[model samples]
Target: MAKTLSVAPKQPQSCAALLEKLSSVLPKGHQFGIYHLSTPPTKTDALCHPPPDQRPDRTYCENHFLAVTIKSESKPSSSEPHADWRPVIVLALEIFIFTTAYSSIFFVSKADSTGYLHLLNLPKGTPSPIREVSSAFLAYLIDKRRRKGIQTTVNLFARAQDQYLFPGSIKNGGKHVLDDRGLVKWWCRVLDPLLEEQQQKQGSPWQVVKGYLLIPGLDHYETRAFIPRTATSAANWVLGHPLEKISHYCQEYDWVPPRCLIPKYPDDPKSRYRDELDEEASNKEQNSGAWRSVKTLEQFWEMMSFRQECSSGRMTGFIWVVFDPKDAEVNRGRVGGTPMPNGTPDQAPPGTPSRNRHALSSATPKSSPKKTFGSPSKQADLGRVEQKKKAKDKKKKKKILKGPIIPRQPRIKTRQRNYLVDRPVSSAYYYWPAEGRGQKIVDESDYKRCTELLLRLDFATLDKAAGSTRRWIEEVGMGSQWGLDVQGKMEMPPAAQGSGTAAGVVNNLSGLVRKKPIEGSEGQGQNGAGVNMLGAGLVRKKRKESTDGAEPNTDGSSHPAPSTAEEPKVNMLGAGMVRKKPKLA
Candidate 1:
């Protein structure tokens, strides 16, 4: 073979080069800008920042954008304006992270989409620019919060849609665009890498991510707004995504976890945002518990389908990044002196005198010995002894509660986990959940082959883009390194190629979902010859003629007589073809 030229991946694109590249790839007059809410809100102008986030931490993730655009007349002739790379208007897609009252508690609120996305008229598929910018900002928040020793959880919704801005998107979903279901998988792929990165570090407390789906009419009947005497119905339905990757991840943590989805407390501003905007409904749900009548997490998602957002034409997905620390006490098991679930120390039964204090205790006045005639000094000594005993009892009661002891009912008033048990870090109380041996796959070779290969190629330069298109096809299409779980073969070095969009077929979903294959189907199968029958072929089956004068049929059945004339055995052309009957005068 002629000496093969090695083609390496191009260096990372710089900010300036990236801006220019994005400007060219994206439509004219559009800029790929990023804006985020500044902490303390005071740093950002009032236009970008809103009122207080109603959070104790003084952190607000939502900020509106001014619909400002650069006119062609005012646009700079040179690339000087792109040098700063700072956004004048940030399209804020809000993701709030409120630490709630405790670590066990988390909040995921959904509001109307206030993002200034009108500027972006890109085609279908969640663009990498949007994904990267949004993910990076949230990742920064999570990292910042985690560094401060706060538990971090991420949340997002999945609703596959064509370009919300472009008018042509309605007619053309564009090629290779992901659908609603695929969007769920795509997002998981996008975020899974982040979770893995965190895992490789000091260990990410979040090990699981669950997606709750809402499909109206298909899941449950329409969730009509009706008043109930009791809070017996729930608006939060829980039809989770059917992706094995997430299900397996969840299994590793809680095999059959309690279906406790998002909690919708009465008038809870943090949980119900968009729905609570209706003052009448807010007050009604406040009184009726938001119709939160679902008994399990699964039911919550089923009910969610009835919402206007997830009506007959739309589907909504709610995702949660679950945080469960590995150092949870489940592995070591609770040691002695572990306080009960309540803030109070492990209780002694009411019948047990050693732990329980009853009315018959000696501390009561009735238990005191009757006053008897005695010296004045002896009577004074007895009174002083009673006072000392009372003081000692008071001291013991104070020790029972390490801090303020608030009695709570199950989910309502439960104390934090580990109670008073000590840990390496005082704030590290994440020792929670079961210790079952969940399915653990240490090897990530499949992740590299399956997940990593599915990412979109970077298109910093035009020539590189065409070459990458071919390289992606050759490496991925051929299964150059084979097998699902086994280590793939060595990656083939990139070969030299001419510029221009690579000429090849691109297989896609074709606006159809893949289902289980028939027993034998040439039309289906991923590895089948990429061919389809054009309406089951053009020819008709041969027709049989009926006998005019028929012989008497036997009990079994009469059969057609065999041809008596015989010919010399010889290979003949058109021997089996049916000939048309000739017409004669």
Candidate 2:
């Protein structure tokens, strides 16, 4: 019965002042009507429940005004409809914490260990083609090229590992330094082959160049001899890495190596090499825009020319003249003292003179397989027999292939239903006529066939038939709205002729003829028959068929009349086509 106080939600004051007034204003049960304080402009509704009998009557006394203030510092309810207030302290504190965290932290990927975490922007489940293709290419190269020299072999192995393991890491300044023990293990395993090759060629020109190449100006004068056919084979296996991955990585990174050195022929002067280098620089950069490397081993192999069991090619900047085991059948068997199978000629060691004296005594003669065949004269006969067998096979193949029948697969028929067709004739093409009278529902087979036919017909006819069909469609509660008959040539029948109600008649007839439409005498009436005849007339008219055969029953079903209906006098629309009406009994 006390006045309802519209106290603005709790207003804030200093802590001490709030406490001093608490006792005086605390509500009801105990000392005062005081409650918590909040900021200005908020509504504070005091929760006033009816005083219970257990409490004193002083609690009901309205004089104890509860200071139930709405505080700005209180947390908001998650379910609250609207809370727009943000205190200055909260805003300042949030900004301070965010700035502190952001400055102290850097984002790290969950895939940091995989080295390809940067490619997360790419869609998940997409495989990296580069890694697989490069690895396959490496295996193929090694199996084909057997590099002998330790230095070249070790470098090739190192390059392969670099390409496969880290891929694009080298271009980004990642050092290739291995741990102390790892370095020793690598040198022993990979470097031993090259060192032994070096040792074998100690007194040769290889040793001379090895020492002189380390000196200053003489470095330019040092000659690089032809890589032994064996050595070249091994070098090709390692080239796959540079060709496949490095080109793309370097091209993207803009880290393409410059062509600073030029190779000279064995007899060409050091001056000539330097001169060609200068001319190359002066030629306005012939190799600047295009890729200077082959970019792929497949390209290298395609460009290769073979010279006596070895394949070699100059790919823009670098010249790799090499041999591979796969390239020659004879060399594969002969390398490393492996014996050639019988009937293959063995080349005498580089420059050894023929030891005819030792060969004659050591030779062991045996009769040839041909000599043992029956008689000496029969050898020629046996050769003829083999030749005739080959000819017979050729003749047999020709006869069988002369006119062999190849059965072609039969094509499955698929009819395209054009739902978007806007033709008048298409409307009736796939139409489902209304259920027969007295039948509760349409026959399933009939309905399915009709639906399918509608699905297959041309769009234009469907467009024309749609008008009559649309009404049938609705009455039947069929699948869709009547397709548009954009041509608008659908005409009212002569029975419904000149009647202002022809449109409604057409709608009724169309509905009746629509498959599964309700069976009743409604569309069978005179109005419905007139509309149906009109539609049939339009179809016959379009095809230039005689409308003479079409007659509408009292039920509006269109049936072909064999010359029984009387023709009404009508205007001639065109050749042999007259607009006429049937005699109604």
Candidate 3:
């Protein structure tokens, strides 16, 4: 009940007729041009040999070879219609080259069948001629190649717009080409299906092969057969050969020598093969930006092995495959009830919750404190308590002796000078009396006598007296008493009154002469020294009494009794020598 499908066959065109058609459509003065260069006798004999057994059968394809070249007129009149056809020719050449470069080769069994001559690979960007030809010729050849199970090497550098160059394009006739590492990954993804189909077809192991071919639009071509190797030795042998050795082998096999194999061209200094000896030097500069330094063949092979392992999904030692418990059980059950491999445990029985074995194994256990055996004796306990009490009492005594803590003021340590050694006895040693002291001490004789008294003191006593006096002056804002200036001395408050060294030194050194008490001076003390009590102690007493509502007897006579806050201010010298005030009242 099957119906026979009949198709019309394509008619062939003569070479003269085809040229005439192309010339009519081309610009004025432009004609189809063809040049034939006969191959050398040695190369012709090599080409006549049959292809290797591993290669695809090409018996169905036409063996006839022809090379087409279209030449454009060199010069044309500017005024002529459409005179400048250079741009058009260039565009057509690009299309022709790109199409032929990537198009698959086709084979025909009949001599009369249509087939366009395959062009040799050209160097990239090389100038070429073009002819106005139908793309139908290319489509016909690809169709025949598909029906005959023939394929061409992949073109990685083809234009992106050429969809047939892509691996999964419909125009590729379901054939694949592994041209790059990315396409290798694509191949790996569907490798299981490919292998299953191959097994089903009972095909030879080397029946299908991937090709990596790079053909620059120049005389040079690079091609490699990607035969699958079952043994590691075979793969290693293929990849381990040096590029130069491989080029030499190809030359011996009647293949055109690659740019890398040729001797340096005398006329062309930029020739690629001109400097083999300089490779190491040039590579040292060129590989500066490379990610890895590949210096040894062993290291290179190791890196390649790692990359191949990664690409083929063989590096699974670090990859853990976790599965749902239910799914894992189902998979295990489907596999003829076989136990899980690699010590993988089976799912827990129904109704029993699964425990996380990893979490339990990794958990740390808590430790408990150890216990003592017996209680201490009462006597020992009492002795311990007594010792603790004694320690507390000691701390209390130390705190009491330490007195109230005072925060230390920030100060810079300065170099201290010893007057006895650093300098001779000067006026700076004289005791400068405090405010309200008797005028007798201000005399030059009194200052000299005071300095002599100070110089006579023992070393220890002199040091004590100097420290106390320096501290008092610093406290009372009278550092000039010690011949110290504000810029050179530390600012500090006066010392407390418990120490009497400073007061004794000031009293003796000043050579103060007490005045006789005048009549009517209340609370006057003997010796009339109360008036000279203008030193630090008396100032503190007067300040305290004044705050208690007592009028200070500035006449230097005696301490006054508490009185009313309102009192007339009196100016007085030591020993009640009162001075008269202005009568503005």
- Which candidate number maximizes lDDT? 1
The digit string of per-residue lDDT tens for model 1 on 409-487 reads 7666566332211211111222111111011111124223522332344322323223333354345334433111111
Scored against the true structure, residue 419 in model 1 reaches a CA lDDT of 21
Per-residue error for 292 in candidate 2, Å, reads 25
Identify the leading candidate in terms of TM-score: 1
For model 2, where is the 10-residue window of minimal lDDT?
89-98
Error of 1 at 277 (Å): 14
- Residue-level lDDT tens digits of model 3 in 1-585: 111223222221113322333334333323333211111001011111111211111121112112232222224543334644211011111011001111122211111100111111222222112212322222222222221111231111211122221111213222222334334222222122222233345532223422222212111111122223333313221222222221212212222112223222212122221232235335433222111233322333334334422334322111000001223322221111233232333542222223343443343112211112111122334666899999999887854345688889999869853221221111111111111111111223333343233233321222232333234223322234321101111112244222333344434544567656566765766555445335642343333246657676677776565565444466334544456787995
Off by over 4 Å in 2: 1-585
* Residue 212 C-alpha lDDT in model 3: 25
Model 3 residue runs over 4 Å out of place are 1-77, 81-87, 91-206, 213-585
| Candidate lDDT (C-alpha), each | 0.33, 0.24, 0.25
How much does each candidate deviate from the true structure in C-alpha RMSD?
25.6, 47.3, 54.8
Sort by TM-score, best first: what order?
A: 1, 3, 2
Worst ten in a row by lDDT for model 1: 46-55
TM-score of every model versus the real structure = 0.34, 0.15, 0.16
What would the TM-score be for candidate 2 when compared with the true structure? 0.15
| lDDT of model 2, residue 422 | 21
